[model samples]
Target: MNLHSAAPRSDDRDGYLVSRRQAWFAFAMTFALMLFDYIDRQVIVSLFPHLKAAWGLSDMQLGSLVSIISIVVAAGGLPVALMADRVSRVKSIFVMATVWSLATISCMFARNFGQLFAARAIVGLGETGYGSVGGALIASLFPKRLRTTLLGAFFAAASLGSVLGVMLGGVVAAHWGWKAAFGVVGVPGLLLAFLYLLVPDYKTVELAPRVGHARHSVRSFARQIVSTLAGSPTVWWTCLGAALQLVVVSMIWSWLPSYFHRYHGAASDHAGMLAAVIVLCGAVGSVIWGVIADRLAVRRPRNKLVMMAILCTATLLVFVTAFGCTMSANLQFLLIALGGFLMMCTVAPTATVVLNVIHPGVRSTGAAILALFQNLFGLAVGPFVGGLLSDAFGLQVALAVMPAFGLFAALCFLLATRTYESELAKVEHIRLDVATSSTSPMTVSA
Candidate 1:
């Protein structure tokens, strides 16, 4: 339990643990795996029409396929991340990728909706700790100053993967069948998982400094975690805000294809391509906004939270106008794309904030808490809620209402900003317990 062996062995003086080459190599491999992770998960979106045409499923049933993954991921993220913190992040990730990839491939063979649903749940189990673990690895591999931007870029892979998944699902399904798309995307992960094993691991860091105990015990471990989490109000608020914002993001990403098909009368394949454009903008927005947030905080760390709050407000406004107003389709599409960019502004920066204030030793575990919020309350809630609203009102009305959740997210970010500077001050004295060999996987969309 007192594994204080997670320090930078090779380059402690400069602050980053690994050499530049090693850092990039790790990033590339992790990024590739993350890309495929989403691809396998999301290829189902473009198949919505096919599945519906075949099964005569309702909107809720269709959305459940996406929501189920986030639900399982949220329920399971903490324990898995805790294990990764204590064991090997890299090995854990390898196994996770392999499991999810295999599960995705299994989706290709399911004969009924129930069977496919069960297979999809397995995919979520495989992805349980990936976002937090991956975030921990990248957070440790790079220098402290670059955390937000690099993490943003890393998460951008989710959108990119979703882009390909959606696009490929439509195109491939158009030529072949829906099952073929899953098989196409799932196989690459197996190769990537094997290659991921080559990435090294850092020693497990202790959760918190010991308090009055002479010997370590599970009681003490749980106690320390409670103490750490209870004291950091920033983590709680940030988690809430991140989860709320992701509600909007996930709704758009999950339903845009359906929206185009239902409203614009686009074919399934064409709808997917149109939706991919917005997702691609989100990928680009995440990185751009992350860099902007990082820059804003260069002088005052609290500025990062300030920027997040502003972005959330901007997203809320953009979406209300885009969806509520009756405009030409092309102009509405443009506004929706802009909203895509603004919507993801918080994805990377939220993780950066969590990493910034939390105890360095239990970074992965801390990140998993954030992941739980992002997955369960945000991404998990989005699609299902959208489906419900779509059924009750219509898809148009559902999309219009989703962005309003950003108001709550913004308030939480503002609340976080109040405590952000003070909490950051506390983390300043803390240092990582550097271990030369170590390993981990994480996010909203991850």
Candidate 2:
């Protein structure tokens, strides 16, 4: 038998993994689910007006419909990701898709604010681990050279899904009712869940650090999981910092339709269509920025953090100018769209940075930790806090001030630059042993 080195051959790395076709096929399924995942989460945004008009709800109550999902997702993400690392990623994903899709469908039948809130919470429960699990699986199957771009593309689905959700919700609600939007988006994910089963998965790999040893204890795994994240100050700073950046993103995405509707006197459908353009810009930016980050890292990987800091600073400047001062509607829209793109520059890079320093065996867990920070501190907080601020200060002032958080996010990313090289150097090199055949089981090449 040929001996496998710690540095794996580019052609045969990531263990005995899927064929090129199978990799893309699996990626397609994962990508589709991710798209629908955000669709369900964001469909509520366009419906905010409808909800408030119907229930006489406060801004916080309306924002709660969106924020609750992220809250529950934050609470549940870690445990679900731990299970995914041990079990099958594909299987876990299928179950999650089904649950969330069903929960989304149920939203159509909710008769009260409390009932709809509960359903939305269930939607979050289903989506809890999907991002971390999906990211881990995507990393494992694709060539390492392509992982960052592909990961960026994968996450861009969230933005695209948001676009679809915001648009579809408005158009559907205009014709039929707000409830019909849930059913329309919900059914496609269920169909995709069944289709996800056809995607092949890699078997779980143990850390087993000892030479010639094939397994490690669960206690060690738990300890390693903690160390994988806690030991890396870069990861620590990235999580908190990236999350702060997302507060700006989530706030803009969640409220743009409302912003346009109230300020420009646009109808719901018109406002949603307008907001979709901005989100589409962000979706495109996520992929492009990932490529930019990757190329900049060719000479020095830590420059990725430097790029993120610059992007955050740029976002702050653009938004402060766009919303902080009165400008023509056309000019403000242009700048806000530009700011939208700048804010997402870190989305792909942050995931890349966190995954870079984590152990292969605990990558999903590491990502989950990042997700916890994002969902709990970033995604969950942005909308509700925006609502609180909107109620107190008005939407225009709230949005203007929100982008300033990106400045803090910039500081955090720069601080992470301090330890990035050291943290990256500390990661163990891994070689997986296995076959190209989809049917073959996985193994680590020692």
Candidate 3:
């Protein structure tokens, strides 16, 4: 295992891990892999309309498929994270990639809603592991100063994948049918799974001394979990804020294509094209935000989270006016693009906060738990509720509901400021107390 830190001291014998260039290279490679991951998952959204028509399904049934995948993935995150923490993270990611890729390809064989739903559920199961492991890897590879930027760039790949998946799924479905589209997009992922092995393995520094390290046990795990949670108010707040943020992010991702079709009277291809453009803008925004976030981190560690709150509030206002008002198609697209940018900003910042607060031993599990809540609240509920509201009220009315969600999210994030600061202070205070307690009494013996 390779260990890396931001600054190396003269006494440090293991200098291999401190190379920033190696870390950056790892970041780039992983970021590329992450793009395919996002593409593989999101291809479903664009394919949804085609699949619905092909299977002659209702909106609720389609929404159920999405809900099941998300809920299952959320439910599965913990176990996967446990495995990732206990085992090789790189190997875990490779396994997840392979499993999900196979599942994605299996969608081609589905002839009905039941079969298709099962495939998506399998995809979710595999993905649960991927996210936790990948996140932990990225966190370990980068230092605090660059953590947000690295994570942001890593997450920004999702936007690029989103654009390709949505656009390609649309175009492919139009020409070759949904099944073939799944086959075309899904097969490439299987190859990428093998490529995961090429990336270098890096782990966080283990503080325990060699040969005398404490062995892990259930009791220690319980203690670790409790301590980790109690120790980091920032982690919980980041989780909560991210959960609320996803309410809007999830709905938009799952249903935006449908929204464009409904409101703008767009055909499948045209709506997808526009949606791709909006997502592309979001990808660009994430990269820009990542750069800004890293720069801000030099001054304030929590600046990333602060950025999230600010962006969420700003986006909420923009969308509230755009969706609530009678706007033209052009104007609506512009507003959605703004909203997308802000929503995308949450991804990198949330990842950084979660990693920063947790211990390396349990980082994967912590990340997975975070993923679980974020998915449950954001992915599972957001789109499903959006569809339900749209069915009862209308599409526009359903979308209008998200501004309130944004406000709730912003509030959660703002409360996090105090919690995070207090928690950090407590950690420092404990360390100082321990240092003083250790050294002060020893002087008398000397």
Candidate 4:
């Protein structure tokens, strides 16, 4: 009998079996840091009125402040994730969290546009790798069945963090000042960075040492990244689709408060509160869709991608009506809230698709690549383009036109469905082959 066909030993099984308590603890801490990461990144949205009043800045300039961070994030995410893969995800996260928190605090000291913009760029630099690495870390701790649900819940923190950032920024700036809003939101991240150090992390299974080469060489690492990307169509399509959908999401989050203030006759804080409610609806939607996607995946693996396509198509319709139609403020807000919910349905499933297709060794880098696309095409372009349009015509016109990108997103997802199942099968086959190979003894020929 070949040793290669033998079942995995008990110790091998034990290696993968982390305690449930430890796993949940890591998830909670990582989720909290993700929360703070966005709180610092997004608090500026709530301070828009104060910044505009103080600096006498135009909408384009204000939008650039938000877009610049995403630009930096897109540029920096890949390199940072590659470094994290080489060094250590947990350590990388701790350092990243500390840097961004400090940068957020530094924003309070800025006396001019250049200084504040530079500070925000630093915040982006620190934040770029956290999501990718954090997702990989969480994936390692849990079984595949739970991936979409956990990742969906994990990303939902962004919505919650954004809500608190905008709401708290408005409330705090109303009382103390906009600078105080920066300082208050910045402090918790510092504490969380240290707290994160205490969480246990599992090494990625595929990256662990094997017989042929105990450690990966620089060339091998480069090759792995290329192969990971080249081998997966799901990765490419999901990234593009998510990026397109995010255009709508970014426009709403970045400009909705301003839209309400300018068009709905609401105060800054009140508008922020209203926008926060809309974003909170997105948070709810992410969790709901995540659960739905998980169930769908079990029932029919291809259904997750189909669901994403459908959701994106639905988002286009609802947001177009919300923005395009003439309606009361209450009615508009409700429709926009519904659009927000539908917009986020793609989040968990996209992340799930990438993780499902890519090898575990390069999972973080794959996520970083997705981040690069999503940020570059979606986060970076959405707000800036919206600002330019708002300048040329009006904010409402800009928003009304942006939802059309969802049609492109939906098309990409539908295309992805064609190849997703086949790609998934390839991954499973490779995994089984690897398992069989790892159990076998090598033979040397003279």
Candidate 5:
């Protein structure tokens, strides 16, 4: 039987054309795991004060703890994602989740900075591949038109998870202890890892038969990665643009609770709750911006990248005002929330652009590459730089200045507009060729 006959058509016009029940199930599970992923990652930030006092740590040391995980993730993401593309995404995710969850649990037993840092690095190992693979899975399960909205909502899970992680970490640490907070948050992910095994997944594009020797698969895989990266300039621009925009996001999420505590004279839990509210606004903004971007794409197909540029521009302006001005704390809080909303608007649209331009054969790898840039530039550097600035100039000054990086991000997106349509057309042509080839009968080897 021809595999193309079994595969779902991309052009089916009836609304909700994908496998509705199974896709939603997979999405829910994937989204839940993403939520936990951030929860485990961000919970440490909420405990910074406690850890500082107990360990006699400096601001830079606290920041390094957060940045180290991203450093590891950025380094490991591409290789692990390539492995997922060649092997099984489902099994890969299961192993990844279990490893991270166990790593999170190990944090509770850490006796010092070295132990804790090593445990966090292990957490990074488990998380590095999950996002790219999950994005590919979700992209495959849904129609192309809904890509932005679906992925926007999917990525928004990070914000929602961060909110819960910070909020709960503060509350738990205040009452029980910082170590207990790690255990409480880490256990649920273990349960979710088990449940995730039941979610449906499609075979990767590389699994489709090609006119190539099995022994040459490794070389072929590396060639595909190189070709995908070289052919799609949009991927390069989008990744860099998203990374630049995320500098503001990483700084805010990493340091906002501390800002509330030191600047506003709020308690640890109070600061965390307030920061979580701001983060929640970003979550809502992601979904709203996704819908708006989709509507704009419908009206003007060329405006997708343009919309991202506009959003990043707005993010730069809003965040700078929110942080740079010395308004009443109430007004600052409101402006910060507003800035978060605008900042988050870039997430879904950028992801949609990446998916649109990359070949399905390397979608996970493409996403992994994007993750590498975003994490390396944004997650790994943003907080550490902010902390260094904080130590030198003060926390408020550091944060106030960070939003300006979004300007560079906006420029990257604007540059991407030039090549977006051309790259998208190329991907569409590749898909058509693949479909045509898939429909042909297989020939027996002589």
Candidate 6:
């Protein structure tokens, strides 16, 4: 029997009418949450110079905190991601939001490395839920045409968060004290925690008919992940590319403030403002790139991923010039902003390409694995690696190293081109086949 709400004719209560405005509002709300999520992650970076002085942190000690925070995300993300697939996304995001917010504010209580490390670890744990579920919900809510554009718009929230975190962290650290930086950036997240409730829960088709069952088990979830990776070359390549991207992205987060202060003689606030400008440029770049990718992909199927490769290469070149070569401080900021813009342009395309190639059932899991690599390797090691290099060489030399990493990311995406094109073709073919099968059926009589 046809339910009245889902009745054959109307696009209403039974049928689930989703307007473009609703889709965008959802994107904006989640985008704001994601913005804060990132603020908590990198707020420490802007505070790093001060935090180091106050906490008596050696480069190695500071590196350890960054490393452990990323490592925990790497180690814990998959397990938690698996859990996300099996639970209420709403509950997971809510709980994770609370955990990270509290953990962030708890930084105010840290008088030692152990306290800070523990707080960072908890923040990582909370981030796992946010990153995994947020993308999945966005994908399910938007139509195919709008998915990448919307995701790009949402992902730009990271830049906004980055801007706020760095600028605020610096301002707060300089004026109030480093501890207050944590509290100021962190406390707002608690308020956003309640906003998570207003967003609609994403609807998904169960893998098997529910049959009144408990959700997926650890063993089963593991199998699904294995199967997903095994079946998906796009996942593999995207992960590889994202890992490299993370390294550079991570390096910037972990070290740029220090670089500016040490080299350009900028104060904390000035350095933080520069970082914020770069991130703000990144936010704008991401939205523009999404629009470009969407418009181009409509004609050329592989344009989205191709654009990612090209932009990464361009970013690598600009970043090398910005950091590796000598220029006036103003010129340096302008070049760096351009690089940030190019690098950020890839986020939407990167996410869109990954989403397009995966089965819907495991989108969260796939996104989880992507996050796992990003945090585990890219974010996990980026800051520490930059620091370690800074300790070994000079800060200038350490700052110069990440462009090479960006180059590597460009290569990974370029290498994956054949696989990406093939898989996307398959996805499109399957979609066309399904549409054809549905429309061409039921010739009943002779």
Best by lDDT: 1
The digit string of per-residue lDDT tens for model 2 on 1-446 reads: 23224665665554335667778888898999999999999998999889889988888888889899889989999999889887777778999999999999999999999999999999999999999899888877876667779899999999999999999999999999999999999999999998887777765666554557555677877887776668888988999998999889999999899999998999999999999999999999999999999898889989999999999999999999999998899999999889988888988889989988887777888899889989998998889999999999999988988888899999999999999888777653565432233432432223
lDDT of 1 at 275: 98
lDDT of 6 by residue, 1-446 (tens): 11211224322222222445655665777887899998988788887788677777877677666667677767777667556665556557777788889999998889887888898888877777567578877876666777788888888888788888888889988888888888987888888887766555443434333436677776875676577667877777778787788787767766777788888888988998877888888889989999999998888767676778888888888888888898887898889878878877667777777777765556677787777777786777778887888888977787677668777777777766767767765443211000011221211111
Say what the RMSD of model 5 is: 4.8
Candidate 1: C-alpha RMSD after superposition = 4.3
TM-score for each candidate, following the candidate numbering: 0.94, 0.94, 0.88, 0.92, 0.92, 0.87
1-446: candidate 4 lDDT, tens digit per residue: 12232354443322323557767888999999999988998899988889999999888888888898889989999988888775677778999999999999999999989999999999998898888889877876676778899999999999999999999999999999999999999999999998887666544445333577577777876886797778788889989999999998989899998998899888999989999999999999999999899999997788998998889899999988988999887888889999999999888889889988887667788899888888889988888899899999999999999989998999998889888888886554222111112211321111
- Count of backbone clashes for each model? 22, 3, 2, 0, 0, 1
Candidate 5 clashes: the total is 0
Q: Compared with the true structure, what per-residue lDDT tens digits does model 5 show for residues 1-446?
A: 23333443556522332347766877999999999999999999889889988999878888888898889989999989888876767668999899999999999999999999999999998898888889888887676778889899999999999999999999999999999999999999999998887766555565245665655466776776797777788899999998998888999999999999888888999899999999999999999989888889887655877887888888878777887877887788888988988888778888888878887777888888889888999888888999999999999999889988988998999898888888886655333111112221321111
Q: Model 2: which ten-residue window has the lowest total lDDT?
A: 434-443
Q: What would the per-residue lDDT of candidate 3 be over residues 302-361, giving only the tens digit for each residue?
A: 676787788888878877877788878787788888888777778777777776666666
Greater lDDT among 3 and 5 belongs to 5
**Residue 284's lDDT in candidate 6:** 94
Instruction: Give Cα-based local distance difference scores for all models.
Output: 0.89, 0.87, 0.72, 0.84, 0.83, 0.73
Alpha-carbon deviation at 157 in model 5, angstroms: 0.4
Ranking of all predicted structures according to TM-score, beginning with the best and ending with the worst: 2, 1, 5, 4, 3, 6
Off by over 4 Å in 5: 1-18, 207-209, 212-217, 429-446
Q: Give the poorly placed runs of model 6, Cα more than 4 Å off.
A: 1-22, 208-225, 425-446
Pick by TM-score: 3 or 5, better one: 5
